[model samples]
Target: MTTVADAVGWDGALDALAERIAPRFCRPEARRRAGQYLAGLLAPVERKNGWQLAEVAGDANPDGVQDFLARMRWDAEAVRDDLRGYVVEHLGDSQAVLVLDETGFVKKGTRSVGVQRQYSGTAGRIENCQIGVFLGYAGRLGHALIDRALYLPQAWAGDEERRRAAWVPEAVAFATKPKLGLAMLERALDAGVPCAWVAADSVYGADSVLRQALVRRRIGYVLAVTSGQRLFPGTVSDWVEDVPADGWHRLSAGDGSKGPRLYDWAHLPFRGAPEEWGKGLLIRRRLADGDLTFYFNFAPAGTALKELVRVAGTRWTIESGFELAKGEVGLDQYEVRSWTGWHRHITLAMLALAFLTVVRTAAIGGKGPGRLGRRTSALDRAGDPSPAPPAARPSDPKTRHRYCLVALAKTSPAAGAALSLETPHPNR
Candidate 1:
């Protein structure tokens, strides 16, 4: 049946959802105002109360607005569990790959969470920015966002001066980006949602501590290492089969593509501390339109080459999520200046991704070729881990899926609305 929301444009669907989820159940008036404000902007424009922004959210009445939302903390755990069920149930037998990526929001000044002179994906260079760690869901059925976290740079944890300058909350402290990524993965596992493989870029991949941590947890992974990354080089000449080829050979991909062209690796069984054991190695390739590269990993035996490719390919999917959220969906365009406001904007982006994923798979049934999603072409790649006993197989149970854009049913022209026949279509 046609609903009032279907009659409007983009604003309709988001407005309907906001009402249903957080709705001004407690502060209807404030939330109502907040809803209207967000519906108007599509860029990083300032929101004003009067002739400024068409609609403004937050407390109209300082006391009621602040009191209502202030008392509210984002239900991150609840949000994760809900998204997990909705996403996994659609999996069927299809393998779900978790793509880990970090995108930075360029901040003009300090004070934003995790803001530092770091590499900003959005800006494509090093700058002062806020970094968000994310997990993207990919299978034949759909491509969607799964979880997120704001990386609190070490400055926030170690230096009191920077912390004070950046307004780092007394409760907020420094945590590594990988640590945050691990926390997000654990949340999904606790909720009983499992991924077939985890993939990342060199930043997280090259971290020895992080790699060992994943090995201990027994999570299957693939990561890119710098050309200079250290590894035991196995024997070059073939030797006796049962001789226990303990001899090591450490080689380099040496400026292969970005760093080196060839790889130097060893297949030593997982060794070192418990968290660093229970793993082996695999070198997989992603043959996309862009230049394909080899990945160096410490994976167990019996892992499939194709499955590793799929998981590694998943990293490209997160790039799509970031592009759509930032450009088409208004991720960084929010006008709210507070820290809470920044997170709320990102949460909305996540919700939008989840909502779109569910709709495309369940209602629209994603199917087609050469849709909106672009293939990946990253200069570097990475992966993740969990400390545990070695698993019997490389990846878990298998499934198949192919994805495309959601088939949105077109709505007839809105009733009682005027159309400007002479106005040229802006898209033209």
Candidate 2:
């Protein structure tokens, strides 16, 4: 059974997290506004828009919340740095994979920054929306989105008036999603995020510049590509479809909602003496429909197929993380229309999700509190002394929602801790 002490401890953990990032805000009022906004986001609210969030935060005027998002002087990037430090501290692993993907935020008006009729995987069709390129860190500890970039279409990029109205910086220029993904990857590496592999869908993998950047960094990756993408076994003309049926080996990328995601896999090494990092074409054929997919893999020579397949499997974690953030934490429910406001809201939402991830990890006996730089793995927590008893398990969406609300509602001295920062919540 849950106890008051347990609730206090949970609240304390969240408060401690907020304290860690509170200094990022320029003023105490900004910090308080940030804390309240985050609490409202994590709370069980049907709509997490400005008005709804402001009401839940006990503010009579929603314009205050809107102003906080629009005119606040807080450093969103500093909060992001804190987030990266927190994630690396708790979830860092030598074998961790950094996954890249983009999600569409549907918006109706043309005035919303970067909104255009475009293809959204979220909707599975062309829709009017803005895209946010995201980078996720997936390790044995757990997965969470650590970085994000707003995708500005070329039309908006060329339109100085629209850019100025949206508060986009003058130095900001048009960059493709893959370039954005690469920039995030570079930032993660520079921040000392311990990762061995990277994974992404074809949209990124198709970019040779991105693949080359990964090779230069000596980071391994299993990135999907179109069948038409050229492969070089003996010659550059070779394509993924050239692989013979006899070469295909049945394998499972990883577990899916239904069961093992089994497929027929094959690989062919690129021609010429292999560099310190090897190059190859990895293919997957569906077991039932016989549909084929391809990946351009870069790893050390003699790397096993299973390792590449495992890295490929890690790609889905970002998707799962997206679903969880959007559904449970209102990642896509924002009413903000400007670039800075969007970043502020999304960054806060990510901070909240990180807190939840930490809570979930602690509940499962994963790790205890400590400074951000010290290395701690799920396997290394056995020797660490416990700080407080674990909070209740947040395995259920409704249960998780209840925990957030209850922890926020019942104010204890410990609960006085303030600001930290979805995907749709998905069934386990």
Best by lDDT: 2
What TM-score does structure 2 among the candidates reach? 0.83
Q: What would the TM-scores of all predictions be?
A: 0.60, 0.83
Range of the 10 consecutive residues with the lowest summed lDDT in candidate 1 = 399-408
lDDT by residue (tens digit), candidate 2, 98-130:
999999999998999899999999999999999
List the candidate 2 regions with Cα displacement exceeding 4 Å: 1-5, 232-246, 272-274, 366-428
Count of backbone clashes for each model?
A: 37, 14
Q: State the lDDT of candidate 1 residue by residue for 1-428, as single tens digits.
A: 32343334233444544443432223455456444434433324453222333423332343433332223434323334444554565442235666778888777766555677998877888888788888776667766677877777676667665554433455566677777777776676565566555677877776667666666666667776544445444321221121123211222322222653222122322233234223433333222332223354544444433334345556767788787667655566544334444554566556656555544454344332112122111111111121122112112111011111111112221211221112222222
Best by TM-score: 2
- How much lDDT does candidate 2 score? 0.76
Return the lDDT, model 2, position 211: 91
All predictions: root-mean-square deviation over Cα? 18.6, 15.9
